[model samples]
Target: MNIKLLSGSVALALTIGVGAVPSGASEKPNVVLMLADNVGYGDIGAYGGGAMRGMPTPVLDQLAAEGLQLTQFLVEPGCTPSRAALMTGRYSVRSGLGTIILGGLPNTLQEEEFTLGEMFKSVGYSTAIVGKWHLGFEEQSWPTRQGFDEYRVGVIETSESTLYRPNMERARIDEATILEAVPHIYESDGQGNLTPVREYTLEYRRQIESDIADAAVNYIARQAAAETPFFLYIGWTHTHYPSLTAPEFTGKSTHRYGDAMMELDHRTGQVLQAIEDAGIEDNTIVLWMSDNGASPDAAPWPDKGGSNGPFRGELGDPTEGSIRTVGMIRWPEKIKPGKTNEMVAIHDILPTLASIVGADLPDDRPYDGVDQSAFLLGQQDMSKREHLLTHVNNKVAALRWRHFRIYPKAYRGSFSNPSQEGLLGVQVEKNGGPDIFNIEMDPREEYSISGDNAWVVAQWLRFVAEYNESLREHPNPPGVTLTDPDFGK
Candidate 1:
C-alpha cells in the first residue's frame, strides 16, 4: 500500500453529469436526512429482521413501503468515515478522515472541505444538524462553522462516551477529576460558540434520542411555518454500545438492543409525524439510513448486538455486512415507491440531493459520487453507480463492480480475537492473485469463484488502477493509523 501524503494544490479536476430537476418542478423539496448509529442491514423490519431480531420497526417499514427501499445501499466501514463521505460526496480519505476519530487527535474535518450543509445553504436553504457531530471538536469543524444555521442537542463524540464516568469509577478514579473529564451534551449558537447543556450521563444517554427527536421535530415545525426550504439532519444515537432505552421504553422489548431499537423507531416516527403535521409530506424528501453495520463486539454484551442479516462480517470490516446497510428515501409524488437492488453509496447522497434541488457542485476537486437523481426520482430504472471502492483507512481494501466483489487481499479472523476483525480483519496477501466473489450469487461471500470468473478480475483491476492514477494527481491527506511515528503531534 503506497500511501502518498497530499501536498499543495493538485489539479485533479472532475466533471460530474447531474440530471436536471423534473419539468414543472417549481418547489425545492425540504430534506430530512436521519442517520442511525450502528444499525445493521437486518435491524429493521423492512429489511427482513425486526420481529425476528426481537425488535419491530413499524415506522421504518411503513416508510419503506411508502417510498424507495434500497437493497444494496453501501457506506464506509466506520462512523466518522461514513459521515464524512455523506457530507463531502467524496471518499473520506480525501478529507483525512478515513477512520474513526479519537478524542484529542489533530485529525479533524478541515475548514476547506465543502459540506452538505454549505451546499444546501448556498442554494438558500436553511440547514441545521441536531445530534452526533463526530467529525471533530474543534471550532473550525463545528456544525455552525461548517454552514449550518443551527446546531442543537448534540454530542461532538461517540455515544459510548456516556459510559466514561462509570468506567472511571469502576477503576477507582477520583470523583472530582472524573467529573472534570466527563463528556457533555452541547448546543451551538449558530456561530462557532458551543455551550454545554448537561453532562452526558447514562440517564441522559437513555433519553438522548428523544431529545434529538424533539429538537428536530421543533425545527421542522418552525421551518415549515416560516415557509423556508430546509435541510434538517437528525443524527440518532441508538443501538450503539451501552445500548440503553428511555424510562418509557426500558422493558418494551426482549433485550437491551431490542429496547433501544424500539426507542429508535418511536423517536423517528415522532419526527416523521412532525413533517406530516406541518403538511410538508408531499414536498419533503425524507432519507432514513444507518451509518454502518452491527458491531460483533456487542454480541458478547447483554444487548446481544444487531443482525447484519446473512452477511458474515461485522462493522468496520471491509465486507458486505460492514458496508451494505438499510437505506430508504421518500418524496411523496416525486419519487416512486418501490424497492431496487441497484447499488447506491453514502457518498452519492450529496450530489444526488444537489441535483434534486438544482444546486451546483464545486468542480475544483474530485468526487467519487455520481448523480443518482434520475434513478432516485424514478426517471431511470437502473442506478447511475456501477462501482464502489471499499477503503480501510488510506488503503483500497476491496472493489465492488456490478454484482462482483473483487478482493486483492483476503481477511482472516481468529476466534480468539474477534474484535480485531473490525480493523479490516487480519489482512493476508493472496499468492494466487485476487479473489473474486459474485455478490448476487454469494451474498455471504463464502465461495470465491476466481477460477471461473477470471475476466471480472481484469475489469475490476481497471477501476482500481484508475483510482490509483487519480491519487497520483490528487493524493489523499494522511489518514488515521496506529503506526504513525508522529503520534498526536
Candidate 2:
C-alpha cells in the first residue's frame, strides 16, 4: 500500500472509465472532505494564484491535477450559512440559521435533522470531523450528536481563537519565539459552556497537527486492516485566522499567509498519502471546497489577502466573488481529470455523495441542494443543478437560477438587528439591482440591469415572489424577541 497520488489530469483519465461501473463500486469510497475557512477561489496553485509561487502546494495541486475542478462553485456569502447548508444539504434559512452564529446564539441546528456525518455513518462509513465545528455550539447539535463518531476540534469560537494550542484551542507562549506552544485546553458540550481539556504548554500545537494527521492515517489503516471501508472528513484548520503552521513550513511560502497555506498544503499531502497507503486512493473520493469566500486582513495586521482572481468581492456579500469558490473532486475510480464550469453549491455535495455511496437521503425533509451525482461521477452530459440560492449577512436573500439573479427591495438583518445592512456596495430598492449583468461576463455584479434588461427584470420579480412565498411558508417572527429561536414561531 504505497501512495497512489495522481496528478489531477492522470487521475481524471483513470476515473472516466469508472463511471460505467455498477453503483456502489468498490464499496463506499472513503470520503475526505477538507475545507479551508474563508479561502478564495484563487488561493491555490491550480487557480493561477501568484502568492503561492514557492509555497509548493503539491498536495492540493496534485488533487486538482488528478481530479475534476469545479470552476463555477457557490457557497454562502458567510461562514455559518454556508457551513449550515453544507452540513445538512438544505438552505440555512430552511434550518433556522440565517448568518454567523456567535458563541451564545440560541437555536443550534436541530439534532432531529439528518446530518451529513450521520448519513455517511448510517451507510457503514466511519465519520470524523476535525477542525471548525461552527454548526451549533450546543452539545445537542455538536458533532458527537450530529453523527460524527469521533471529533478532535473545539466549537465555533474555537476557530477564531488561536490555531497553535496543544489542545488546539488555547493560546500559548514560549519563553522566546512564541513557537509551537501548547496551552491548557477546555471542552464544551457545543453550547457556550466549557470544561478543562488538557494542561497548558504541555503539548506543542505542531504535534497536534501531526496528531490530527496521524488520527486520520490510523483511521484509514484501521478500516483497511479490519476489511471495512470508511469515510474520513479531514476538516483542516489552517489558511485561517491567527495563521500558524508547522515550523517546517514557516517562511516556506514567503509571507505569513503563504507559510500557513504551505503547511496546510503539506498536511494535506500527509492525509492523501495516508489514504493511498491504505490502498484506497483509487476508490476514495476526496472533495475539497472552501467554507466561504476570502476573508479580509488574512495577514500583516490590518491587510488581508486571498487571491479571489477576477472576482471583485469578499466574504459577507451576496456577490459572485463572495459566494463563488473553487471546488475539486478527486475519485481515481469514478472521475476523469478535467474542469467543468457547472454552477454548483455546497448543498449539492450531500445528495451527490449520498447517492454515490448508495445511501438514501430522507425525502420527508426538503433538500434545497441538487443531486449532481451524474455530473460528479462524470456520467451525465452536464449538470442537473440549474440554479443556486444564497442568504447571508442579516436576512437578505438571492437566487441564481439559469442566467437570472433576483434580490428584492426589502429584507431585514437577522431579527435582532433589523436595520443593519446585509451586503456592501449593493442596494435593494423597490426596484432590485439598479445594475445586474450575466454572471459569466459580470462576475463583478457591478452592471445595473433594472431598467435595461427586461427579461432579467421579469425573472427578478418572479424570483422575489417565490422567495416571499417561501418566507410565508416559514413561521413568522415572534413579537419583540428578535434574536431568540422563537422568531420562527
Candidate 3:
C-alpha cells in the first residue's frame, strides 16, 4: 500500500482535549457510521419532520441534540453511488458506479480501489460492515474482499429483491427455480469464506433492520473488549421501497412508512445503548446520516411518507431534495453540539475519518474529498468544502458552489412514470444556458436567477475545466449503463 503517516505535530493538532485522555484509553477513537436508506431531509425531527410527519424519532432527535447537526449534508442521486463515494472518498463516476447496481450487473467495487474499511485496517483498527452491501454480487466484490473484516446479516442486493420470490410465484414459476434465482441473507468470515444464512423473504425483510442492529451491537461489544479500536459501518434498510414494519412495531404510526421510521429509530437506539453500556461513549465517534433523499416512487398517497424539507425534487433527480439529506455526528466534548449550514458530502467521510485516526491517505490516486478534521473539531469557523459536483449516470448534472446551484442539465419528476423518474428522470437538456439558483434564498428552486448571476456560471465553468484537465492523466473507468454493450467488461 502506498501510504503516508501523519507527523506527531499534525496528529496532536487533530486531537481534541489534548491532555485529557483517560489512562489506558486508545489514542484513536472508535467510529460507528449508521447510514439510513432513502431517507429525506425532512424525514427526521432534527430537520423538521418527525412528530409532524406522524413518526416521532425520539432517539434520533435526541442524538441530534447531543451532536453537531449538518443542515446541508449532500449525497449522490442513488444508493449505490452514495455508498461508492462513502467507501472510496472519490466520485462514484471514478469507480464506474455512478448509478444503482443491478443484481446481474458487472459493476463491482474493484480490488485496486482502497476502501474505508481497508484504511481503518491499515491503522490497526478492526473493521466490519453490517447490512446492505450493494456494490456488487461477485465474490471479489464482497465486503470481506473490499476491506471489512466481517460481514453479517446483510444482503448483496437491494431490499426490493425481497419481493422477487413472491413476484416469481405470481408468474407461476416453480418454487425451486425461484429459490435458485433469488438472493439470500449472507455473512462473511473475512477469510474469503461467504455463506448464506437464510432466505431473504418478505417476512425477513420486515425484521432485517432489527437483525442488523443486533449484529452491530454484538460486534461493538466484542470490539470494546479488545485492545484495538474498531470501525463499524451499519447500512440500515428503512424508508426504502416496500417499507414493512416489524410485528412489534405495526400500527405504531399513521402509515407503513411512518411505522418503519419508528422501527428505525428504536433499533438505532439499541446500537447507541450498546455503546453506552460498553462504557465507550466518551471515546467513540458516531455519525448518523441518510444515503439519499426520499423516493416519491416508493408508494402513493398517504403511504408515501417522506418530505425533502424545503428543497425541490426527489431521490433520483439532480435537484436539491434529491441529493441533500439529514446528517449528524457526535463525539462527546470533542465536537460542540449545534447546527450549521456548512456543506459536507458523503465522499468526505473516508478522508475525514482517516485524518482523525492519524492515517495518511494513499498517494497512488487522486482524491476528491478534502480533510475536514480541523473544521469538524471546532478549530475553524467554516467548512473547508465550498463546492460539490453532482452526477447521474456518470454525467455532470449539477454543481453546488457556496449558495449557488448550477445545472448544466436539468431534470424533473415525470408524473406519467414516477418509478422511471426515480431511477432515471426526464431530462431537460436545452435550457438556453445553465440554470442557476440561489439555494439560500430560494430553497425550493422555483425560479432561475441565471440572467443576473453570469459571474457564478463563469466560476463554475472554470472549476469544471480544471477537473476535465485532470482526467487526461487519470481517466475514470467505464461507467455502468444499460445500453453499453461492454458494460462490466
Candidate 4:
C-alpha cells in the first residue's frame, strides 16, 4: 500500500449521478446528526433491549416513537470507513479509508473530498463536530479544516494500550494503567488553529461524554438564540472499546457496557431536550444513528459490548449484524412519526441532507449514496435505494438486492470470534457459485438460499460487475494508512 496523497481532482474523477431534488420551502431546518459510536441494533428499548438488558433507554425509545424508525439501515464494518462514508456521501474505498487507522499515521481523509461540514457550510449553515473525529489527526485533515465552523475533537489515532506496545504486552493493565492510556482532547476554531482543551487521562475519559453533551447543548442554545441555522455533528464515543461509564451512570446497568449505553442514551436525551428548550424542535431535523454494528468482543466481559439483536455476526464481519444497526430521524410536523423497513445507509445522509437544504454535491466524483429525502419525508412510497454493496476492508464482501443478499464465500466466524476472510470472500466472479440469502426473511443469515435463488445470484453479480467497472475507471486506493507501504508499520 503506497501511502501517497492522491491529487484532488486528478485522482478522484468527477461523475455525478442524479439525487433527490430539494423542496420549495424557504426555511431550511437546522440539522442535528447524533452518532452513537458502537451502540447496537438491540441496545435501545425501541429495538428491544431496554430494562431487560439492565439498561432502560427511555429517551431513545421515545425518540424512535416520535420519528421514523428505519429497521434496515446499514453502515461500514468499522469506524474509519463508516465515518468516511458518512462524511463524504461516498464509499470508504473512494476516500482510501476502507479500514481503520492505526497508530500515528497521516490523515485518512484527503483534502479534496467533499464532507458534510463543507456541504452544510456551503448552504450558509454553521457547522460543528463535537466528540470523536477519527478521520484524520493531521492539521489539514482535521474537522476544522474539513468545513466545520467550530469543533471539539478527540482521539486522533486509537491506541492499543496507550502505553509502549512492547511494555504493555508484559505489564498488567489495572485501572491506573488504563487511565494513563486515555486519548487527548482539542478545540478548534474552524480555521487552521487547534487549542488543547484537555490532556488524555482516566478522569477525562470518564467525564468526556458528559462534557461533550454540555458543549453541544450550549452550542445549540447559542446558535438558536442568535437565530442561526447550524449543523451539529455529535459523534458520541460511548460503548466503544474499553467502555467507560461515568460516575452517575456506573452501576446503573447490569454490566459496564450496559452502563455506558445508559449514559449515552441519557446524553442523547439531553441534547434533544436542549433543542426543544431552544424552541427549535419543529425547525430541526434530528437524526440518530450508530456508526456501525455492535461489537460482542469490546470489553471482553460476558455479554458485554452491544447486541445486533437477532442478527448474527459482530462488528468486523460482513454479515447482516455487522453492517446493520439502528437509525431514526425526527422532524416535528415535517416528518410523520412511523417506521419503515427501507434500506438506508450512513452514506445516504449527506446527499439526503444536501437535497433538503438545496445544496449541490460535488459533481466530480461517483457517489455510492442516493438521496432518500423524498422517501424519508413520505413523498415517495418506496426508497430509491435498492442495492447495497457490503465491503470489509478493500474487498466487496457481499451484495444485497431488494430482499436477497449474495455472498461469494461462506462466513464461518462465531459470536465470540469474527472473521472477514474466507475462500471466496473476494470480489464476485461472473459465474461464481456464491452463497445467496433472503436477508429479509433470515436477518440472522443462518440459512442460505443459494441453490433456490439463481436470479438473486445473477442480479448480485451484475451489480458487482458494474461497481467493479467503476472501480477500474476510478481506481481508488484505501484511504487508511495501516496498510500503507511505510506509513505506520
Candidate 2 per-residue C-alpha lDDT over 279-360 given as tens digits, one digit per residue, 9 for 90 to 100: 8788778888887777642233522456576675667657666777878999886688988887778987776676666666
Cα lDDT tens digits, model 3, 440-479, are 9999998889898878988678767766766676688887
lDDT tens digits, residue span 1-489, model 4:
011111221121111212222343336788999988877888888888877788899999999999999998999887788899999988787888887775454447888988999988887888888888888766778888899888775555442223343355457666575445445677875355777766655456678789889999999999996645789999898777556768898888768888889899999999999999999998899999998887775434543658889887767657777788999999887688998888888988887787677777766677787777777777768776777787764778888777887788666643334433221123334465888878768887878777777777777767777777777657786454343387544
In order of appearance, the predictions have TM-scores of: 0.92, 0.80, 0.93, 0.87
In model 4, the runs with Cα more than 4 Å from the true position are 1-26, 158-182, 302-305, 414-432, 478-489
If candidate 2 were superposed on the true structure by all CA atoms, what would the RMSD be?
Answer: 8.5
lDDT per residue as tens, model 1, 174-226: 99988876878888773558899899998888878888999998999999976
Error of 4 at 54 (Å): 1.6
Which has the higher TM-score value, candidate number 1 or candidate number 2? 1
- For candidate 3, the lDDT comes to 0.83
* Model 2 TM-score (2 dp): 0.80
Least accurate 10 contiguous residues by lDDT in model 3: 3-12
